[model samples]
Target chain A: MSNNYNTDGDRMIDCFLNLGELMLRAGAEVNRVEDTIRRIGHAYEFERVEIFTINNMISLTVISNDGRVYTQTRRVSVAAVDLEKVARANELSRQICAHPVPLEEFKARIADIAENTRHYGKRMRYIASVVSATAFTVFFGGNWVEALISGAVSIILVTCMLFSDRLKIRPIIAILVSAFVMTMCVQGVTHFVEAATMDSIIMGNIMLLIPGLALTTSIRDVITGDTVAGLMGICDALLKAFAIAVGCVSAMLIFK
Target chain B: MTYLVQIIAAVFSAIGFSLLFNIHGRKLIITAVGGAITWGVYLIVFTQTENVFLACFVATMAIMAFAEIMARIAKTPVIILLVPMLVPMVPGGDLYRMMTNLVMDNSGQVRFYGHQLVMEVGAIAFGIIVISTAMQLILKMHAHITEQRRARH
Candidate 1:
């Protein structure tokens, strides 16, 4: 969604590249992204297709029916955990493979999937953040009092996340800043809350920020032998984990 | 009380995650129940084997297989259910404790928890690889058997 470049080309190749870029941004594994592009290209009457995908870049080559070669590389954005987007992209790609569409229609459908599919409303997202963090607090053996505090702290965290997202902030800075602010808020509140340990509270909220998608996707990529993509995913997860740790440690130090 | 809390918490965590991921309809319920099953299986195996890695490995294989079956029925990608199903298996509490130990300069505790974390992650990766490879072989055998039948006929 960041860069829409090179609108003029074999529209069929454009659709293939667009779908690949969408799938990658939506956090599909590298294999899945490459598979989607190849399938879509062949379905559109391309004589042959070859694809190479990593965590953040996808390059594809298609030999059209006339044997003209069209090669395109799309720079993918950082992935997020919207399985809905992935599922939708997968379904769309499959449908196109079964019954190839005109390039114009293919482009439109891909754009619609990118923007207009029903996402969980903002309210639902906020509630989910609270419920998950609170349940995790109890699951982590926190007292009810600590669990309650974790719930309140999650709202503040979610707000920070949404605000940063709206302002188009980079994900790394958003994560690092939110983790620090949330931990500082938790520490400040627990000081007066009598017997509410900071450990369980922080543990519960940390679940919200953990790199679940990157970790899981990386595992799959590695298992599937996409070692480069897998390594990139691992690196991304490590950086995010480090940011969270630095944030927590700094906040704790502030109180110290 | 503790068992009940653990099961319910696992389910709710899955629900929360499913919603956050924008998963809709029956997929949401299946993914949430999948989380509870994962926790239940992990607890049973861990208590019996007293091995963290073994427990995680078994639990992961169980859930991934379950997701594969459900995905076939629902005609959705397996990752939809598989990812959220594994949420409860992550030791968020232990991870936080490890980071805290690092902050406090408790190197011994850091090493302990860090080792445990790596093992759990390794279990998940290996379990997934083993099952997927097995599934592929099964499919290949099935295809070969059908081909043989056609040739015989």
Candidate 2:
């Protein structure tokens, strides 16, 4: 490790904070985000690095061996499950740990990563949503006709999600609206086609609404001893589930 | 024949989820296989014991083990594979049923589904903890033995 690299404290702090913000916004778990920040600090020859992360914020302090201290706090409000960006950021941290680079180079690399990685396009996402809903109908033992109905309902749900994303609606509200739309469509279709089983179709399509990622991540966090993060995740999942149920029930009441 | 259909459905569902998560290329197929294995084990266990909780636990263990091994081989985080694969086993249907029962004022059925939901979620959580801890221990032991061998050399 190079001990006297003459690195500016402010630039190092900016780089570290940028990495932390990118990872958190990309939906890396709290523990992983903290660990990455610590590793990055250590790689840059920081004497001590401390990080405290909550559900929506991160605070970090890095102390150089020369007794200079730099502290920064980032407020992260927009968190989506983008594992690809998380993977990219993880790889960047690993690279930083393996080979220390100049601040300018590091900033440029981060910029490139942020720009290059992209989410699946809107059309592909819609197709994936439809496919999962239709496949789940079969998994739930629904017949082919029911699968078709579920897939059609999923198309509407996906469009609603896209529109909600454009309008910057809250996730809870978006989920509720999507669930209501799905149930209403399913019910309307069933009225015309007497053979369509409403229960199976709704049940199958509802898989899209379930917070499986949050539930599993929360359980993993709790088991790993990050009780606070885990609890936050659980509460989020439960609230989303409640919203979905309320939406479905309200739609049923109106349609029935 | 029916089991085959179920397994294929699980595969398709997993692939769809992986795509939604932007998991591309070879990792996508591997994730689908992981899902198939989980659903296959789940069906076998459920059929033999008629116990949903145990079935979910055993299947979760299988998926976790598969994920750990795949993560090691692919050099990717375990979560990339684990999250998409576990989607099939989630009790989404039971949750929907529980809410429906509540709305219908059927307290008995609501309680029934609610209990099942808790047990299923608990069983899966327990399975994850057990497998993850065991894998970490095994990795540590392997590292220690390799260090000893290097010293002897």
- The residue pairs found clashing in candidate 1 are none
| Cα lDDT of model 2 by residue, B62-96, tens digit | 99999999988887777778888999998998998
State residue A242's C-alpha deviation in candidate 2, in Å.
Answer: 0.2
Cα lDDT of model 2 by residue, A81-149, tens digit: 677877788888989999988888999988876778877888898899889999999998899999999
lDDT of 1 by residue, B44-105 (tens): 99889999999999999999899988988888888788888888887666678899999899
Tens digits of per-residue lDDT for model 1, A125-225: 99998999998988888889999999999999999999999898988788999999999999999898888989888988899998855776687687778
Worst 10 residues of 2 chain A by lDDT: A1-10
What is the TM-score of each predicted model, taking all chains together? 0.95, 0.96
Which ten-residue region of model 2 chain B has the weakest summed lDDT? Answer: B71-80
Docking category for candidate 1? medium
Evaluated at residue A149, the lDDT of candidate 2 is: 90
Top candidate when judged by TM-score against the true structure: 2
Off by over 4 Å in 2: A4-6
